[model samples]
Target: MTFKPLLAAALLATTAIAAPAFAGTKMKTEMSATPTSNIVETAVSVDALSTLVAAVQAADLAGALSADGPFTVFAPTNDAFGALPAGTVDTLLKPENKGTLSNILTSHVVAGSYDAASIIALAKANDGKAKLTTLSGAELKAYVKDGKVYVKDENGGKATVATADVQTSNGVVHVVTSVLLPK
Candidate 1:
């Protein structure tokens, strides 16, 4: 048995043994690399949006948001919710206040997907502010100030975009520094 032939055979055997494992890993990676989570699932996976997730569930808007939305959600973080007047979140979560909660939540969401760039461009074209009509028929103003994107509710409550363009299966989420309340 020549050394060269023995080495070649060993190399071939090693490649054959590794190929299946490599293929399996590659397939698994590809599967996981694609984002399959809808807006609700995406929100649930994000720790900072836990409060928002709870609010969505409470308002029974999770199913709607999880649908084939292509919605643009101005999602407020836990801190944003906490910064509200004490008892506000709790009150909104109550069964009797479901309508109010849904209104507020819907105000933060536009019907179509709008990434940061699109919002900014729209604002710029509209003379520094663009009105985004929500699912509730309420309008939220989007503007760029000092190179940062800001969303202002009809009542003048404003939130800075903390994180932008979190893509999901149904839509995209833009984390807001404060909850955008409806007028």
Candidate 2:
């Protein structure tokens, strides 16, 4: 009855509830928000981000993320996690790797609300790239390539925004195609 077992079960159940999130699959997300939409809520509502919702629970970040505050989360789709090496996600979800898992998850978050337009403006102002300090204290850079927005982690990981400008009450969720790991 440990947290990890429960976490895995919950994730499995969610995957069953939502449409399978696969890589390179064009995902359509809600662009408008109601008063109830938040980062975690928006993610859960999306069929492409079921894995992300599960990780937030496993990392014990659901409460914190659901709190009142501006948090811009660069969420990775299920396909993004699937793109990782075999067993990488499984290993990270283990109880022993909670700290690492938390750090990795936080690496995708930034304090304060930043919409896609602002991010693009910042990137434009910064001469095509804007370096962002993540909630995990790691640095990720945002840049536009081929008319699409992308964020690069310190560890050379890059995640492209599959869907942008998903408004939420707490902040915004930009669905990305890869999991940006911590440095």
Candidate 3:
């Protein structure tokens, strides 16, 4: 029962007991360190983009989007799909209309990475409208209305960027209020 041996044992026991609490804090930090999802995964996670996700799958565009892409997508919400004329979305979903659906979806996609600030600057340079050539070979005009960016399609259909610059692993998504139709 020497004092030195007793003190050494006490120190060892204290360290061993305190290690678990520090380890528990480390585990909590690790749990929160989980990375963010990519664009397609982000779309799936959002409740508003369900229809857009379905259309992407139906058009066979999911794989391309999910893969490496610094793509800028003007993602339309489910309410945007619902805003179409009666039976429009159902008709587009038909197998025979896959080509048309593909075209429509592609028109909403641009080749490069365009965040809201850069797009706004481009618009400012080009007379308040930035002409973006889409993946479908169609042109989309980005303009600012009431200080918010809006992308206009060929048919005079306008989709407001209701939510701007949602950063993803591959690219950015500007959630639009309306579906953009190809001319």
Candidate 4:
């Protein structure tokens, strides 16, 4: 089979074995030491972050994302992309839509390192909500309910943080099940 099919199978197997790997793992410094670049280098890295990875490379943001950012990225998984409306991913991947795709992906990222506590505090301070400005010039609103963090976009679409605090050398990553669309 082709690489994409093989990759999908591998990812499925890994997912079956791990079943939300970030959910139970504590944020250890050693685990955190896994460089974002290295993650991007690994065999299944691109598969796990298929859509966002493509967008990053297409947008020429790979170097910036691999740099010493201390950024906080809310990464959507392959399943999240699969859940998108039919043709959405294909359209985003087109050369003409590269800029738009990049903007949407980068909109999920914030400039500095923000841990869960910091995020929660920001939410509480804003009357249980916080508006975060992303590197892409878009805004994302964060709110905490029942101790779970939820992010909403300008278009009013929301995605819950399914797993949090997946730390990387360059930044922290929170896994969200759905894509957060920009207005």
By lDDT, the best candidate is: 2
Question: How high is the CA lDDT of each candidate model?
Answer: 0.73, 0.75, 0.72, 0.65
Writing each residue's lDDT as its tens digit, candidate 2 over 1-183 gives: 112122222222322111122223234553334446667766666667778788888889988888887988899989999999999988888888889999999999999888766787788789888888999999999887765668999988888877766667798777788999886
74-152 per-residue lDDT for model 4 (tens digits):
7787788899999988888788987888888888889988767677778778887777889887898877655456888
Instruction: For each candidate, give its TM-score against the true structure.
Output: 0.80, 0.82, 0.79, 0.75
- For residues 1-183, could you state the per-residue lDDT of candidate 1 as single tens digits? 011111222211211111121122111101110256677766665567789989998988888987898999988989999999999999999999999999999988898988766776787789889889999888999876665667899888999776666667887777788998887
RMSD of 3: 17.0
lDDT of 3 by residue, 6-123 (tens): 1222221211111121121111100010024466766766667889988888898888886688889989989999999999999998889999999999999997788766887798
lDDT over C-alpha atoms for residue 132 of model 3: 94
- lDDT (Cα) of model 1: 0.73
Better of 1 and 2 by TM-score: 2
**Clash totals, every prediction:** 0, 0, 0, 0
Q: Which 10-residue window of candidate 1 scores lowest in summed lDDT?
A: 24-33
Question: What would you estimate as the lDDT of candidate 4?
Answer: 0.65
How big is the positional error of residue 92 in model 2, measured in Å on the Cα after superposition? 1.2
